[model samples]
Target: MAYRQGVTELLRILASAVTALLVAAPSLAPAQSSQPVLEISGASFRPLPIAIAPPIAVGDEAAAADEIYEALTFDLQVSGLFEVVPRKAFLADPREPVGPEGIAWTRWSDVGAESLVKFEVTKGAQGPKASFKLYGIASQRLDLGSTLEGRRADARRIGHRFADELVKHFTKEPGAFSTRVAFVKRAKNSKEIWVADFDGRNAAPVTDRGGISLLPAWSPNGAELAFTFFKKSMEYPNGHPQLWKANLGNGRSSAFVGRGDLNSGASYSPDGSKVAFTLSTDGNPEIYVVNADGSGLKRITHSEGINASPSWSPDGKRIAFVSDRHGTPQIFVMDADGGNVERLTRQGNYNQTPAWSPRGDLIAFTARDERIVFDIFVVDVATKEVKRITQDQGQNEHPAWAPNGRMLMFSSDRGGKKSLWVSSADGNVQRKLGLADDGEYTDPAWGPFTK
Candidate 1:
């Protein structure tokens, strides 16, 4: 039941920790909308210039409005889709009316603001009610608007919700702003699972078991996480790394695959019905799949060399994994039933930790180059073209795709101490996620959008 062979070395290869924050859900209400949607093409992409006026607050909601403004501004800055004009550049009043008719379009246009945003927050019986409006400067028309009622403690969520709507209005798809990223927070003698907001806000631990935990994976529903846990406790004096599932709602964890000699690299299917992971039950590490509750165990890879890090395709019809059978660790893919296996990455001799994108077009992975430095890369699933994401970044690894597939989060020591970093998939925009300076974090798993 415990991994007595190669477990210690494996632990060193996949070490990580965690932090998280939680808030109550808020109700949504659709406001006014009229739009000549913005069309953005990658070949000729330019960040949209937008001005966000200071949020107006009524009654005792100043603090809530400020929180919402901070969160919303951060979300847009990192989105890679907009250039948020600075407040210092503002020619218009910060306390502008939310209605389109009362707006001074000429002043905003003078500052080169293609679009403008205005919001107001009022104290509500339930909490804080935030109303948002987006204006197209050229058209001088209201493009999109929404009102979200959230708890005062969750004013940040209200901001995130409006940001998501802003993204959807232009891209026709929801933004990943409302999602969370789960990472392993490493301390002196402990490694725990932590979930932070997509922007790395309000990070706190979700796991407290005294053990080595790594490679956290989010369930499709964003309600649970499956990670590898190794602990030497009363039941098992010998520490073993096995897959464990943690419920985000109640902070409860249970063994999902405790029978194997080693269980790691848990990946949930798109439907959340089953999980694909690495198991070493037969002495050789290989990919395996089982029901979410740890039933119906089935081996997915039968290889002499190590096979691990199974990532499920968005359609739940295929899996991307790592294998060393071809003489070097490389990315590989196979059908959901473990048939039709094919190699994915042919460029790197030491490529591993493949994470299938939600769009199913690219698989982000970690590769060691001739310089012996590890960095993140993504391979086009259809064309087999490999694109390096992190260059000369300090030991970047464990690439986890954002829910929208437009961006990804990876662990890097570039800022020192192995913190989480997010990057636009094209490697054009990158930012270090704001995490604590004292702790080491790794193995980021970006969660799906919350329901």
Candidate 2:
């Protein structure tokens, strides 16, 4: 009931804040019905036949926009939602500053194309600007059009944004291919938290206090991070580990729970009203829920053994956690109010870091095999079906799901050093995150994008 009460209070606060802000600046309020709705059924209906022609050159600029067009086309194709017809395959190119002419719609229809994208490149004050237009094949009407201004080096990001907008026009859900990941970077002497765009660009260290920071978890809004840091001194070599929250936007941070002893593994509630963390201040490591402002602390579990890794369900109705209360670590689920506790895993000898999927269907955790090799596995909450997700190589652990629940990000030693790797929810298409100078990066946590 504490979690529920905390969430209720948070919702009330947010509602009041929004109301006050709206009242103070009515003009700043967003339009009630500005968002367009694209039915998910559209995905099953039919993928639009899209044709992307090379950008028309402007002035003396070279052919730099070709790479941007290719990247954008590839991004749309990977989403499993678009049918891109090659320009070479087409009888004629649908270049910009011109309309669909004698070109056979029959050819596109034969190729299963339902849409077309035509673009042109122009020289801008800053750099090259790309102008694109999307047209529905059947209606021969424009669906969306926009111009992106950026330097040649930033063409990739601009292309991703363009594709993302295109996906939103047809799918209703925001595309996450352009999002970034935040995680903790650890070394022998100290640990720091870092963040990078999804493609592993613009990675920078967030903490540089020289303490042993670990277990970085993102707030639902992606504006703040919760992590644990150990303060070392001559008298206490091991140091005292405490939980801290950092506001990424303004570089402001504060200690979340300063009771000291050992407070770590903090995860924010789905609504960002409360945080569930493990505290050993009471002798044994146990799970506790507290308000976002660090008030009204309530213990959730009182098992004899260690209980940690609390993850909230998407609807904020239940929490999935890991517990060794049954001797070895196993996945457990309980109501948000800390009632109706039940065990969810039975096959694995050891299971830890249970992450509840955002889709609210499966729970991912690290399971050790008979050979004591740890790998990632998912368990269906309803059917209790256990499926192993990781297959080869060294230990793979700390599986974190993307906001859309389409893929997972986890830490692995498969690349000779501990680095972040992403795979489909079923553990396919595994690829390294390609971070800069990978020096033992672990415990990756994906954050929701604000836009």
Candidate 3:
């Protein structure tokens, strides 16, 4: 049965190519703007200036321990929340405290160091253990101290956790540098789903069977995934593509919706009781709400034109979606019950794939250059101001916000092929995720941390 379903989806894709072209007409033009707006906010307090002394080596010599220290130092510097002072300027080693006075606070202040990070690497039975201490120059006291144990192979992860703790003690927000990303990859005739750590390590495929699997949406708890798959050859066999759910813990999966013409673009609500999805079961693609268990299906939009890609607001009272009821695809907001539809994007000729941020203050979506390319953009819900997050790249689309709403993940073809990329919510730090050979990753939905 699954084999037949896969073949049917492929026929639908070929048949829908003409309709897609018609709906995507206006997107073929180049978007023009005199200047682009970039969002930047100032921190409430000045960042602390700190120094990290070279780690003190203990026992036998080991190159892996030294490499771990170097990577940790680099992580702290790139976070942009700290100013690291040079270790060469330290007058005394932390291994020898100058008298009980705890080193000279005046000397550190003179050298422009407001804090100090001293670490000692010791060989343990299991592996290496790094002991660290943080000292504050202003208070003239030790602020924090701890020891972390890990195998030499996991040295980088240990370092990242240590740096995260330091940031939390000072900034009051957990650092996002240790998170992970999940995305879909497609190359030529092979399609697979994968998950990787934030730094693009330990990438492994979750699915081995190659069929037309697309549009992966992570559950709020990050334990399950909802996506669309094409497995049959019949033309619109059961109405639309089928939706399936996969449980990451046990590798169990099952069909969620199969009676529709197209059951794609599914997202879980913040509270996790319901799912917002795009369905064409009613003849025209429209936004629909259904229980997470696939019961109590309810249509939310009654517009005459195409309406799809529904994303629930953080409060769960409203939903953001893409609609062509205005003659072109644009972002629209509607009540969860399908009342009070309002247009959100007036300037962009083609805007689609609306995703509400978990923070509840903004909505991110893909805005195409009415000429030839697509880029990610965000809209402030209260102010109604729009900010383009990606510049001229091959094609950037399918944006999903992080759990904290401080970062976003999307797919782009900038490096000559489609790959997943992540950026700060403000568009400051943008970087690619996944191996170069992974090939054409798309539809990245950032999931919440499970542990």
**Residue lDDT tens for model 3, 1-451:** 9989989998899879978865533222222221121122465534457877667777852464576566566556545456677667776655654222446667677878877776777887677888777776665555677788788776666676787777666665666656666778787786767777655566767666567777877887778888887656567543347788888888877788876678888878888899988888668998888999999999889888899888989889999999999798999998889999888888778898898998798999998787768999999888889998899767999898876676788888899888888776766557776466747788777777556
lDDT of 2 at 204: 85
Ranking by TM-score: 1, 3, 2
lDDT values for all models: 0.86, 0.77, 0.74
Error of 1 at 337 (Å): 1.9
Clashes of 2: 5
Off by over 4 Å in 1: 1-34, 40-42, 99-102, 233-238
- Candidate 2: regions farther than 4 A off: 1-118, 125-127, 133-144, 150-154
RMSD of each: 18.3, 15.1, 22.1
Candidate 2 backbone collisions, by pair:
1-337, 48-114, 49-113, 49-114, 49-115
Q: Residue-wise lDDT of candidate 2 within 1-451, one digit each (tens)? A: 9999999999999999999865443132223233234444423444455777656767754455775686687566545455577667775534434244433555555655777677777787788788877655555555677888788776667777888888777776777767778887876677889888765656888888877888888999989999887867685588777788888998776887867477888889999999998888767888889998889889888889888889999999999988888888899999877889999999977999988898899999999999989899999999989998887779999998888776788899987888888776666456676687747889898888777
In model 1, what is the error at residue 10, expressed in angstroms? Answer: 87
Candidate 3 local accuracy as lDDT?
0.74
Per-residue CA lDDT of model 1 for 1-451, tens digit only, reads: 2575578766665553111111111112222354545566557778889989889999999999999998888888777888889889999877667766567788999998998888999977789999888877776666677889888878898898999999898888889988889999998888899989888887989999878888898888899999999957676676888888899999999987977578888999999999998888778998889999899999988879999999999999999999999899999999999999999788868998899999889999999999999999999999999988889878999999989998888999887678988887777778888788878999999989777
* TM-score against truth, every candidate: 0.87, 0.77, 0.78
